[model samples]
Target: MNFLKSTYGAMMLVGLLAVSCNRDEDMQQGTDTEEEQAVETSSEGEDASDDALEMAYQGEHQLSVSGGRVKNTLCATVTNDKVNKIITIDFGDGCVGPYGRERKGKIFIAYSSEVGDSIANRIITFGDFFVNNKGVTGTIELRDVSINADGNLQSTKRLKDLTITFPNGQKVVYNGSRTREWLAGAGDDDPTNNKYKITGTVTGESTTGRSFTQEIVEPIIADWSCAAQGNFARVSGVVEMTKLNGYSVRKRTVYYGDGECDNVITITTFRRTYTITVDN
Candidate 1:
């Protein structure tokens, strides 16, 4: 009788241990998924904002070159105030723009002077903007636009209270400052040739309520030609993302590849490294 009782007790102990181990594994998996989602969603938001900035600059350039005569374009309806140096672009109900992305609502740009002029500042705000069914709310201000020592045009990109809400009701908040340097194709009439290098640090709260900090360890290459060809706008770079909560602190290093125009990116986590093809 004593031997039987001891055996039964040991069996129960083993069962409880198994359940605890399984529960821990499940929690870890859940957290990993959340980290991935957070990075992905934040990246999407940044991409949309970059497109909007480019559009606004193009519109301003067109107006400046045309003596404020052109008001409408294939992408959106543009309106400008020459005296105030303000430009408003309304995408209206919805329209398919470059890269096969659907955008709607409006973008307002208040420029200190001509967009590329030295020391000029452009303050950009959104009005009910929706990109591919995701709502974006934020202020993106380009400050101190000037030519750098390398003969490249550069500006300080500031994002304030930028919030991106997914179609599934999840919201991600982003705030950061980045430096963008125009590397080439500045004089081209075709925007697809434009390229820029971006370096910055971003900290935000993910859709799953996890806070993370991102640092661009390598300057990210933003090539419009790649995006125009249905690829991700960011061609190459390395980003380190650190999650602030969960079972443990998670650090993810993302590699965008060696200047390839593909949508593939590899992410290295504490547990493993994985690749994902983004639908840009």
Candidate 2:
């Protein structure tokens, strides 16, 4: 599998949270900005985010890259205040999907919210984040990144000092940035009409001179009814994969959720449907 196609679900599914927190700007001064590497012994810590966002994060989002399905668990809590929170998503230990792909990682995101002068709302930006997927460890630097008062994520995400180790012992180093947004729908009223959709644009290259631009297709709506021990259930409308290597649109994928805490999803792409079984 190619790079984008392989990691597509991981990046795209998480982008679903780009929607705003009620469109009202939450501005604060001297917001507690600190990174606590200490994993709280208790799964439950503090509280943060609005109901919609809180439910989404606490539940967590995961995507299996191929026909084979995978399950993961998510844990998110306010370490201190609303601005400061910790989100951890575990994709399990060496889960296998398709095309000889096996991944095991726990993505940890620590962020603080502050008002921004320009660009995004500067509501909640990441102070430090590490993504481990398929033996790839990427440290994320979110600078001036904010989900605007409008709830559209407005910031440039810089991935620095990234090293992905292949099963064969070969490693690739990459650094890149991805800007995200909430495309359509505002609230959680109607999934068909008021879907909380989000998208992103990634423009970055690897140390090996592999330059890439990815335009992430937004989902139709978001589902946040299920929240128990970081078990999330989501159904995406349709997604597009734009490979900028030669500027071509590759695949269009759609999702259908069972709307149950069972965490199973039906993924459709190019007239072929794949049943993805997600678990906590």
TM-score of 2: 0.35
lDDT of each: 0.79, 0.34
Candidate 2: tens digits of C-alpha lDDT, residues 1-280: 7887869977776565443322212221111110000001000001111122332233222221111223333322222222444444343444432112233344444444321122322222222222222244545554665567886645554546454433334344434554534344333232222223434444444322334343445533343334222333234433333332322234434343434443444543333555544322
Candidate 1 local distance difference test against the native: 0.79
In TM-score terms, which candidate is top? 1
* Tens-digit lDDT string for candidate 1 (1-280): 9999999999999999999988766645656567667767766567777777777777766656665446545367777776877788888899887677888999889987664453678888899988778787888888877899999989999989888788888787878899999998786667788899999998888765667788899999999899889888898998888654444665678888899799888888777788888765
Q: Candidates' TM-scores? A: 0.83, 0.35
At residue 5, give the lDDT of candidate 1.
100
**Candidate 1 TM-score, C-alpha based:** 0.83
